[model samples]
Target: MSTDLIFSDATKLAELIRTRAVSPVEVVQAHLDRIGAVNPKLNAIVTVAEGALEAARAAEAAVMAGVALGPLHGVPFSAKDSIDTAGVPTQRGSPIFKGRIPDTDATSVARLKGAGAILLAKTNLPEFSYSTETDNLLTGRANNPWNYDRTPGGSSGGESAAIAAGMSPLGLGTDLAISIRGPAANTGIIGLKATHGRVPMTGIWPRVPRRNWHVGPMARSVRDVAVAYSLLAGADGADGFSTTPLRFDTGVGSSPDQPLRVGWLVEPGFGLIDSEVAATVQKAAEALHGVGCVVEPVRIPALEQENALDIFWRLHRMEVKPAFAAVTAGHEDEMFTISKAMLGEPDTALVDFVRLEQAAERLRDGFAEYFQRYDALLCPVLPIPAHAHGLAEFVINGRTVPATHSLSATVPLNVTGLPGLSIRFGTSRDGLPIGVQLVSRWFAESTILYLASLLETASPVRDLHPDI
Candidate 1:
């Protein structure tokens, strides 16, 4: 069935294309034939969108003319070539924006193509998205559909290796640190970031640290990041940090009925983790304390100083290195040697960016006074999991460090705009995967999608997969 409809899930391919049993041009030619059979061993979809199957054959001729569809109507996603998609080619994997095309779209891809989804491809990142791992020089290294020699984590590593190898069920990454919850916890899927301005960042791009810029969704189910976070949350008055007003719920009282109060954190006391990634994030806080929550272990002394990776490298060398000094002035030999060594370093003053924005407003007022007595916080999205490909050091557990200190647990939720996520609860003993995140507070992404749908129903790597 179109190769099992490339591992279904965008709420079951938008309920089989809203009951026509399927046919938005057979789900965009079964994800363009699962991106031409696994995107040549996981380079993870670099472009592929020229009129995506004629917009899935005009969304299967508007479902045989009955029209009225939307809620990912024809379902098929994928973004993160630094978003924007008007006429497709968002080459942010940069060769100085090689064939860069963008006339519009990217208010979360124009609200997931106005909720009926179907963008069909763009993925790949790291250049200008500025590395977590995915390569660049213009569309290269993405790998890790379980372990293509590791790493699928990056500046949204090709939208988490094209939604963990099914090519694309949903996507849209972009995070400032550990981009999209560390490649959706190194490709086991389900990422979210959601709260620094709850969505809108208009047409995106090297748009400076719009307060730790965000833009979320990346799925493999949490009901497709709750139907792409209810059409990518509110406020589109051009992202003045997306002016609040988002209130998401995702039905079933968004999960937590009570007895909650969760909060785990194995050694956030300065990096180097991985005792099997702190026992799989303490078995996802013992699977949310076997379903009634109240999980313990707290901590948070402003993320155990050692200047949490020097306050995200002094907010990326004083505000994301001056938005690439005018887009790499005179093309600096077509950029990306780590974006010409982060725009030929040296700059940080203005009183050291006002003492690193007053130590990032005291770690965002100490995680808003530790989420006022915790209701959500579990941790470890990356302190070592999918390492290897070109890494400049990062062993963990047996020490080793220095990979720009693996953004010390996702740059304190991009310096406390909070709302982290991640999910995928376990694997690793060389089986890869292993996630955790959660976080919350500050537009509580529906309480971290109701404790990640209760640790994805006590996860056992819920529905496993990766045999691409």
Candidate 2:
């Protein structure tokens, strides 16, 4: 019963709790037990919530009293360590901030708690949440649940690993580039990087390059992500970027009025992708086509002309380096590999910065033009499946590329502030998970999410879990 409870989806758990088939204490304790069992091997959850059981007891009382409940009432959720949690240690996986605790919750965390979800724990991440690998001096490293030697991707790698391992049914992860989606792909779970500014980033770290960062949900099912997004969306007033008025439809498990037009691409624009990953994307496109949606091979010329990966690195380096320098001023020796690497890189030239900014605008325009004819676009989430830990480079399609190349497909969405969803649709030759990315134009989360629900039903890898 405990095993089944830990593996249940967040929505199912909520329903079970509401119906009295299961109590909130049972749900929370099941997750705590799972974390106690698996977290030592994975190091995914750095700090378990202190008052989780107490919160669960209070929720049980509410249920017994027949009080109105929130959509996620009695469900247990986790958050990446970089996201602030009131009274919980949010060390950001760096020694510089060791033993640090925030007095307030991040907007994303607060919204989830507001929905009556208990905070289960805080997952691990790279130092300052900067790397594509989840490792730092403070928390050591997060191992993949599927294969201890492989990574779960980062900087939300630990969150993805926790969800995949059934330690938590839902989680909140922040994405700067590939942090949320790439990690989800690596773990064979689902993650949503909603339209930028749709969810407030208030109370999170490193506000510089604020336009690129996002907070979204990671879960085992699309419906949980959809419900969490509904609760997390809308302007918080405190975050200037989150000014999008509360007016969009969640559109989960529903179809548009007309047949949707979708496009899929894996080459020329997103760097060199593994054949297996590309084939999975092709299969997803075909699946959508099979469902009566008009799908075809397409390309966005801007991605080809202006490499999104290059533009992201050039612009973000200029914006984030100073922020890193400021925070690590007195704690230089405590800085980790990722923070050191960012600081050591040469500054972006003024001319290049201007050019890259314009190029980013062109990429947005390109997507805008494409969306005029297509409702959504499908692509690869990562160039390859999760690789062995601590590797500096990857060889894909017979070409060796820097580890940063993993950001090729994902950074473009961040650059344009567009919405993208990562869902597992296939498996790799090495028995690892492979996910395809679904993207939509700005503020069209409903389209991609609704379409994701359809793809979720058609996915060949449904209900698959890692044998932890």
Candidate 3:
């Protein structure tokens, strides 16, 4: 029962708890035991919340009293280290912020707790949550559960790994570029990147530029993602940029009556993608087509321009670099290699920064125009599957590219402030998981969710899990 509990999705776990099939204390303890068994090798969970069992006991009492329960009542969830969890240490995968404990929970974390979800632990990530891989001087690398020699994808790698290994049924991860979806793809789980600002950035570390930063849910099933997203969406007053209201009908959207116009691209007018990944994306498109989606091959001319990656890099380097410079000045040696490089770079001139911002706006406009013709765009989440640990480069379509280009297909969505969701579709030749992202216009998460539902149902890879 404990092993079965570890592999269950949050929604199912919630139901079991609500029906008195499992006590909250039992659910929490099952996950704690799973974490203790698997976390040493994966290093996915950086810090376990101090009073998880105590919280679970209170939840069980509420259940026994026949009190009305929230949707996630007693379902255990993990949070990316960047998210504050009151008593838990949110080290942000860095020594600079070591032992940092916030008195208040992040808006998303608070909302999840309000929904009766138990916060079990904090997951690891790259230092300052800045890198594409989940390895830091503070917490060791979060290895892929499927293949320990490979990366899980970052900076949400820890959260993804935890979900994959059954350490937590659901978790929260932030995506500036591909942090959420990339790791999900690598780890064979579901990750949603809500439209920027839809989920508040309050109580999260190093608040990047508002238009690119987004918080979303990660879980094993689409329904779990939907359940968590409903609670996570909505603006918190602390984040001025999160003023947009979230409007999504999971029940209706999950089973849309009308056929959807889903535009999919394998190359995506950017970096090279492995043949296996390209094929899996095609399979996803076909699965959507089989489920009444009018899948078509399409390209976004604006994304073909070389400036997409440049625009993303420039904005991040210009804004996030300065924000962390003060803390990193004398502590360069303590920071991760990527963090040092990011902070050490010279600042961009005002004119150059403005030009980059304008370019990004144009890119966003292009996606807006494309979305008018299609309900959502489906593309490979990452150009390649999980790669070797400590890898600095990858071979894509016979060409060597810097590993950072993995963000090419994903960062554009962040630039456009659009929503995207990655769902596992197939497996690589090496048996690594292959997933694709369904991207939608800003605030059109429901459309993507609808398309993802179709793919999730049709894909044979849904029940596949890594053996520890």
Task: Give the best candidate by TM-score.
Answer: 2
How many clashes in each structure? 1, 0, 0
> Tens-digit lDDT track for model 3 on 1-468?
998999999999999999999999999999999999999999999999989999999999999999999999998999999999998888888888889888989999999999999999999999888888999998889999999999999989999999999999999998988899999999999999988878889988776555678889999999999889989888788898788777642222434666678898976586688999999989888888887778899998888864677888877788787678877878787888988888768788889889988998889888878977888888999999999988788888788998888898888888878888999999988999999999877788778877787788888887888999
Residue 330 in model 1: lDDT:
86
* Model 2 Cα lDDT, one tens digit per residue, 1-468: 998998899999999999999999999999999999999999999999889999999999999999999999999999999999999998999998999999999999999999999998999999998899999999989999989999999999999999999999999999999999999999999999999999999989987668899999999999999999999999998999998865764333324557888889998789899999999999999999888888899988988998888888889888888888998998989999778978999988899899999999999999989988888899999999999998889899898988889999999999999999999999999999999999987888888888889889999999988887
Q: What's the TM-score of each model vs. the native?
A: 0.36, 0.98, 0.97
Higher-ranked by TM-score: 2 or 3: 2
Between the candidate structures 1 and 3, which one is better when assessed by TM-score? 3
- Every candidate's CA RMSD: 19.0, 1.5, 1.7
Better of 2 and 3 by lDDT: 2
Give the whole-model CA lDDT for all candidates, comma-separated: 0.81, 0.92, 0.88
